[model samples]
Target: MQLLYACVNVCVFLGGLAEEVDEKVLHAAFIPFGDITDIQIPLDYETEKHRGFAFIEFELAEVND
Candidate 1:
């Protein structure tokens, strides 16, 4: 079977985050690194709050530097 993967830029995985952290906080904290394309924070269904982690996607792979 051929596996197809989507093209993605530099992505950062952050764990052990506080539930209070949100997209805005992440954007502000990471913007100095590079242009951020997206931020995803998974939430707990019961509390409707963040799951103590997030994914940050940068516009360019160079952000890995």
Candidate 2:
């Protein structure tokens, strides 16, 4: 599972998310690894809602590992 933590940028895909997931929740989850550069949660255009996936970018590249 450490391999999953080793990336400056990672795209997290959630499975069967019961509710809408926001950027704050994702940021908190990744903060332990390193500084967060940015977080993007793609939402549906028609419904204007989260798509159950997010992209997290860390400040340092080495933090990915």
Candidate 3:
């Protein structure tokens, strides 16, 4: 079986203030997922900050479950 898993990590600078988080912070949070094949974090070019979410791809279904 072929399976793909996507995960998102959000960081709130002031807790409940999602707008205050940075892209770097979000990226750092995702580091522990382990064996991630692909990662994408959309950000605002003007501010160069995280959109408060991320997308990660894992090739193995069993690893996620």
Candidate 4:
């Protein structure tokens, strides 16, 4: 019997980011590394601003290197 395996990519976390940073900024900064699947920056409802961190998902796991 043969088995197949599927690799899963992991999301990269960036902390200490400026509140002014947004999805666009993150994209521009990370796009050069590889194709980005998604970018998420959690925000505070009260201030309606980023929570000083962001998550970046690259299309390939190699980009993490």
The number of the candidate with the highest lDDT is: 1
TM per model?
A: 0.78, 0.63, 0.41, 0.74
Clashes of 1: 0
Clashes in model 4: which pairs? Answer: none
Off by over 4 Å in 2: 1-18, 61-65
3 against 4, candidate with superior lDDT: 4
Candidate 1 residue-wise lDDT, 1-65, digit = tens? 86322338888888999767889999999999998988888778898888888889889754353
Candidate-wise lDDT, in order: 0.83, 0.65, 0.52, 0.78
Query: What is the per-residue lDDT of model 2 for residues 1-65, given as tens digits with 9 covering 90 to 100?
Result: 33323344554444444345687777777799887777767667898887666667767465454
In candidate 3, the residue pairs with backbone N, CA or C atoms under 3 Å apart (3 or more residues apart, or in different chains) clash, namely none
lDDT of 4 by residue, 1-65 (tens): 75222224657888999767889999999999988887878778899887888788878655353
Task: List the candidates ranked by TM-score, beginning with the highest.
Answer: 1, 4, 2, 3
**lDDT preference between candidates 2 and 4, better one:** 4
Ten-residue region with minimum lDDT total, candidate 1: 1-10
Name the candidate, 1 or 3, with the larger TM-score value.
1
- Displacement of residue 2 (Cα, Å) in model 1 is 18
TM-score of 2: 0.63
Off by over 4 Å in 4: 1-8, 61-65
Clashes of each: 0, 4, 0, 0
> Highest TM-score, which number?
1
